[model samples]
Target: MADDTSGLSVPPKKLSHSELKEYAPGLQPRKMTAKYEKQKETLLRDRKSIQQLHKQRVHRGQSAATQKYESRMERKKIDREKKLYPRNREWKDADYFIDQYLKREAQMKTERVRARKIQNVEVKGNDEVMFVARVAADFECSPKVQKIFRELRLYKPYTAVFLRRSGENLKKLALVRRQIRVVKPIRQQVEDLIRTRGFAKVDKQRVALSSNQVIEERFGEHGFVCIEDLADTLMKGDEEKFNLVTHFMWPFKIDEAFNDQSNKVPGVGRSAADSGRHLQDKVEQFPFRFMDSLMEQACRRGKSRHWMGPELIKALPSKKEAKFLMKVKRKKVALKAKERKIQAKFDAIAETDRKVARKLRREHKQQREEKKAAALASKNKSWKVAMKKSAKAKEKKEAKRRGEDRRLIAMYGKKKSTAKKRPPKKQSKVE
Candidate 1:
């Protein structure tokens, strides 16, 4: 019988330190050899059994769950199909449906007609000429506006009518006699016509059209008629005629006329003063007013004192002064040509320098990239070497630890076997 006051018994040890070293160098001190080995084997077998049982349970649960889910999903699919394909009549009345359908059709037809009308209107005035005509009508009505209409009629084959601003009152003019002539610049002509009629009198409304009217009318199809015929008719008597002639000849500048002494000509009398002043005025306003007349007279007299071009230049005086002026002009042109050549050379040198700088910058950038790659490669190689060394050290340490663990286990096994064979300890009674 066991004593009630006694403590639990410990297993006996068999192997000593030297004995363990001779028999099994792997064994540790103070361990039960046999019991430890037995316990280790039992623990390993239990672990494998538990793993197998857990795996079987998981597989059974997954199979049952999947079968249940599939059955539920099949029932739901059948119910959804039944709902989508109903056999009963959901709408029993046909009269209301037909009326709604017909109403929608009528609405669509009306919309289609409206869309077609809009498309037709867009196509009708798609040309640029029509577009310009519409834009011109937006501005105030003037002679210039009429002139634009005339030009549009002359150039475009399409017939366009201008509408007056008095609420859609459109006027369709006849294009049967439309003709365009490149008259001398009409602005200058208007200015001359106004100036020759006396600026003060013209400003005072002596002329039927003011300078602005004359300018605006020049652009008009019939405005030039008022300028040529109306203006000539309005100027009556000698004073008015003289003032008109002078104004026409000296439109902008009155100072360009020669002095009275310079106006003297061979066999010319006092009566010719008026004619001379008119001729002087025409000369002062040359190219602006009577360019064609000047060109013709210059051609006839063999004197190139005209405003035309080289033909007129040749007709100028063949004196020493004129020759000297031509030489000076030639010298200035030659100097300009030399300056342009020097500028070209400087531009070429600058372009070459820019290209060379760009090339050097590209090479420097490439060198930087190579250097960075070299550094990164060196770093990677060093890291790989360090990792290999660390792995080898870890393996060595693990082998040493495994050897120690085996020694401890073997010693424990031996001690356990010895303990099982030892005689039981005598116990005292505690009655």
Candidate 2:
């Protein structure tokens, strides 16, 4: 120990090993306050106690490795549950499924051929898609056309429906061909709708086909796990699967009113397509244009693929449409401005006449009010006169009943002092 320099003999304090070591030029040991040291000690003690209690409660004595393994196995179970019924995610069973689909398609083809033979109608281009729109409103349509519209499920104008290019279906379509325009469906527009606007039935509820789960759950037996697979099935004319999917999906509501109305010739009965009335040249763009902005909004929300069906149905107009509307709106504003100017000019020219007309109107109103008051006063006087006449008649009748002079009382205006005091009715003295 080093000797003490003070007069009193005091022991020199020993420095800690950490403190004994020289740090870098400016670096020094952190100075700890008494409160800080106390807090650190208490925290360490509490942590130790918690760990001991946790260990005691977990009597299973499972180690970290075992717990980690159990958690991993639980995750694997969830992943397995999420997997398709086949247990294999890949389309390994696609060949057998395709064969099954082909067999059904062949059966449908045979049925259609038999139907065509009976109907004596030939349907060409089996792969072509027809886009049909109802040009007539339900209220104005004929009974026969109304029944056809009901069958097609299009009861309103701007309503669109799709038809397959098959013989029997084409025969049905031909019945309403005049009312609806049948055009070739655009592949891009169709694909976009299938991708964005498509829905699948889940638990009897219409759920959006955002994830592959609903498609897999419903169509997994047929080897379809996603939208692309479903589209391919429809393209290949897998009748059963196609019908099931179509029934599951809701009808596409298309608004073709966004097109130009100038082409609507007053007497012409032709379609807008023939008359060049469409706002967009590409017919396919109509549906996608109405639905594109909505899909973009959905995508922007950074939502997971599990969005519901109604959200996808909320279609908004596009920038081009907004511009068209703005142009139309400007014309409307100009017309309104012109009308307002005409109205103002008429008001200015007739200002003095209008003031004189107002004075005459006020005078007529006052006369009407005075006439009404006079009529009311006359009614009251007539009521009082009637009451007095009724009273006089009643009094005369009473006087006549008593054998008194009713005529004399009326002429004299006095009742003859209570009718001569009833002449002191003669009474014989009873013996």
Candidate 3:
């Protein structure tokens, strides 16, 4: 029992450095082994530090060593690239521009998917089927808002595009609600949209309609025979058919809302969304719907189908009618020229008469001013003459009195003839 206790109590000895080195060759110490390991650690630390510093310097473009390495790598990469693509290996400004353009277009196509999507959208029973149209021409919207407009194909002011009343579409329209006008779908307007400003997809290209045959050819399988049928399909809320027709149709360009009214396109400069009257309210208050008014104007401007019929009261002008119109235009032009000539002559005579009247008035004023000045000068001259006459008379009377005094002195015989000397005629010069 005592020997078992001693054996069980004994602990294992730790391995010596020699034994560790013998088992693991890497653990063996050489000359300056500690110093070497220390130096290795220091070298590794310095290398890591250098690598970090090199990364920073490369980012700052301040590392010559990194620059050289990049240049070498670039040369190798260029060589590889040249081997890979030798046909159009030369890069130019135009190539760069084309690359940028393709990139931007691809990015735009991808970015269009980010608008809010509505799931399980439905057109329930008794729900009014309506479409929204953009009326404002503000293109300086936010990127997301502009992308929404671009997706809707409303590129300019008064360009109308039909929008379904789906939740997703409603959300998209709400983003640009201030700039757009929502209205009750007018059948006439929709027909006009398809007839005049409509484009159909022909061979995957947007081409204007030549006849109802184009629609029949493309949508005949879907039972759309003409423009009216297509418009009817859109109105019935058939999602698949509606999307196809809208996609085939180009954006409809219309005139401004009214002639005199300024285009109060919301989101242009100020927040028109918060303005006094909502755009929808204003649209509802209009005498005719915005699009209907536009359609009316278009109908008036376009010749009637009746006029295109067999009747000859107001048919489209033929060559003979065109010549007659030209002759009438020339005669009208001659009459206008004569009227302008007569008006010019009358204007010239009136202008000359006005000049004469102005000249007479100015001469009369000058004459009155000159006469007053001459009258004042004459009065002053008369006063000067009267004073000169008075002075001469007084001098003559003084001379006579002096002579009488001299005669009295002579008669009296006192103070002798200290008498008076008369002035010589030449010295006096009394003329």
Candidate 4:
């Protein structure tokens, strides 16, 4: 207790902990102001970070120890699978499912084949892969064949796909095999194909394999060391790697002009190989020409393998061509102008002739009218003379009988003169 100035007893004010801490070094309460909103923002930011942490923990939580070891292992495996490939977030879910389904089916097929081998049952599958080029589009075929085409990705004409010669594949292929030309491309042809028409799929876009460097960069270290290796592998590599090699390449699209080329050259190698294999007891082969056929085959083979230097490009007319055309058009225009000028000159001459003819016609008409008038005047003059003579004779006879002229009468019944029309008055001048 302490005494105040007025002599009344007073108690000393106690210092609160917060007030003491505020006065202490490096410890003070926050300043309050309406302008500052950083505190609330900081709180909100902390809340969001905490929520993220909680979600992470929940998503990555471990299995309980009380759970069975098998169940925990299964749960961990499911979590790993979900993390590795989230089904909900995938766009190609059906493709994944199909892949899994195919893998399972392949396993089953192997098991069945094993059982059949043990039981001495027959099995069918081909090891060789052939280059199948679609020459004709036959959507009008039955739905089964259309489905096969869809699977093979050979719906477009002049496009080719690599197809394994499995029994099932061949059976499906034979249904429409005539429309497709299947041939085993040689090493040279394979290299030529990759060199000329090789394209790679990058991010679902077709990128042209412009050089050997591009091919090496893309497919090195895995299977192919260089473009040559890839081409050779595609041609005569292990049959197992055939599908894998083909997957790197886009379907080959032969130009329309080269559509039937594979068809023609398919027998070139085979015919050459078996030409002398059997010379006798085959058929009555007379004068079998070889040079022409060989040359044609060689030409076709060259054209089929290599691409031309540059495609035909259409362009606007050049300055020289345009100038020549302009000169031609100018000549035509000048000829037309000269023709019009000649026509105009001829028209002027015709007009002058027409004017002269018209003037002569008018003069002749006037002369005819004048001649008629003169003849009528002469006849009228003669008639009038006869009439006057008769009238005078009669008048003389009457005069001889009467001998006195009648008295003249004065003008008394004449009409009065009418008023003349007045002339229009002119406008007065402005002041």
Candidates 2 and 4 compared: the better one by TM-score is 2
Clash pairs detected, candidate 4? none
Query: Where does the lowest 10-residue lDDT sum fall in candidate 4?
Result: 307-316
After TM-score superposition, the amount by which residue 11's alpha carbon in candidate 3 deviates from its true location, in angstroms, is 99
Instruction: Residues 265-336, candidate 4: write the lDDT tens digits.
Output: 221122322322222112123111112211122223354222110111011234687699899989989998
Across 288-386, the per-residue lDDT of candidate 2 in tens digits comes to: 332221123333443311221222213224468669989998998999899989999999879978899999999999999999999999999999999
lDDT of 2 at 184: 51
- Displacement of residue 416 (Cα, Å) in model 2 is 57
**Candidate 2 stretches greater than 4 Å from native:** 1-125, 201-205, 256-431
Which numbered prediction scores highest in lDDT against the true structure? 3
Off by over 4 Å in 3: 1-128, 203-206, 256-288, 291-431
TM-score of 2: 0.33
lDDT of each: 0.44, 0.59, 0.62, 0.58
Q: How far off is model 3, as Cα RMSD?
A: 30.4
Model 1 regions more than 4 Å off: 1-237, 241-318, 414-431
Q: How far does residue 267 in candidate 4 sit from its true spot (Å)? A: 31
Question: For every model shown, what is its TM-score relative to the native structure?
Answer: 0.31, 0.33, 0.33, 0.31
lDDT by residue for model 1 (207-226), tens: 43344565344335533333
RMSD of each: 42.3, 29.6, 30.4, 31.4
Q: What is candidate 1's CA lDDT for residue 172?
A: 17
